[model samples]
Target: MSLRAARDDDMAWLRRHYHQRRAAEFAPLGWPAAALDAFLDQQFALQHQHYTRYYADAQFLIVERDAAPIGRLYLLRRAPEHLLVDIGLDANQRGQGLGAALIAAAQDDAAASGRGLRLHVEHGNDAARRLYQRLGFEHEENLPTHAAMRWRAREPVATD
Candidate 1:
């Protein structure tokens, strides 16, 4: 898999991906399908504006495999800590090791820079939470809607 800078043309796909991933989350709230779509449309626009305004310098990347877009990864490279703002895969592309590989690469980058990698996962996202834990991330704090996690660079062991 490879990453390319997200372009204006990608906005539609990003919106669709966001909608698909979040639909199930809102399904439990008992909203009708049409109502859910309307709600998501407004929410997504607000979220996109917020991210662009606040994280203008963050790298907005589209994850691609074989020249086809498969996901998105937004990362903010900062001193002492690298924030993984968001990472999502197409529903069909998930559970195939792509996310893991991307995260592992981020971990390697963080270690090389002596920085910690941090992210927030939705509280109900058990699969993602498990993946983070299995990759050595520790729960840092619980937010209103999400759990903050951190993975620090491991200290080198002295060889005998």
Candidate 2:
């Protein structure tokens, strides 16, 4: 399997993934229905717009197996860190360690770029939060229905 930046072509797949997986977190957060509808459209449109400045800023990754896309990860850069805005593996691809592999890939990417791994998981998503915790991330803040988490590289060793 390989993980690489997603192409504009992958937008269709990404939207299908999100549309099918809309979080139950929003209802608890009281997110306005119309507001969420617009937000989702704008978020997906950014990838389709090839001429936008954000084209290069946002990172969309596609996980491929034997040249076929099996999963997607969407990231947003916010100055000090890379935020994991979305991640999804095909249902058949789940429970086979692909999710962990993706995070490991992100960890290496973050280490190389000198930025910490960051994400916002719905507060009610115990499954994902537990997975993040197991991957060495720590809770940083709560956003009503969600929580921000971070994984930082350990400090350098002391010289002899």
lDDT of each: 0.92, 0.75
Worst 10 residues of 1 by lDDT: 76-85
State which candidate has the highest TM-score: 1
- The collision pairs in model 2 are 6-60
**Clash count of each predicted structure:** 0, 1
Candidate 2 ranges beyond 4 A from true positions: 23-56, 76-79
- Superposed by TM-score, candidate 1 places the C-alpha of residue 92 at a distance from the truth, in angstroms, of 0.8
Error of 1 at 88 (Å): 0.4
For residues 59-116, write the lDDT of model 1, one tens digit per residue: 9999998998889999888887999989999999999998998999888988888898
Clash pairs, model 1 backbone: none
Q: Model 2: how far is 16 from its true place, Å?
A: 2.3
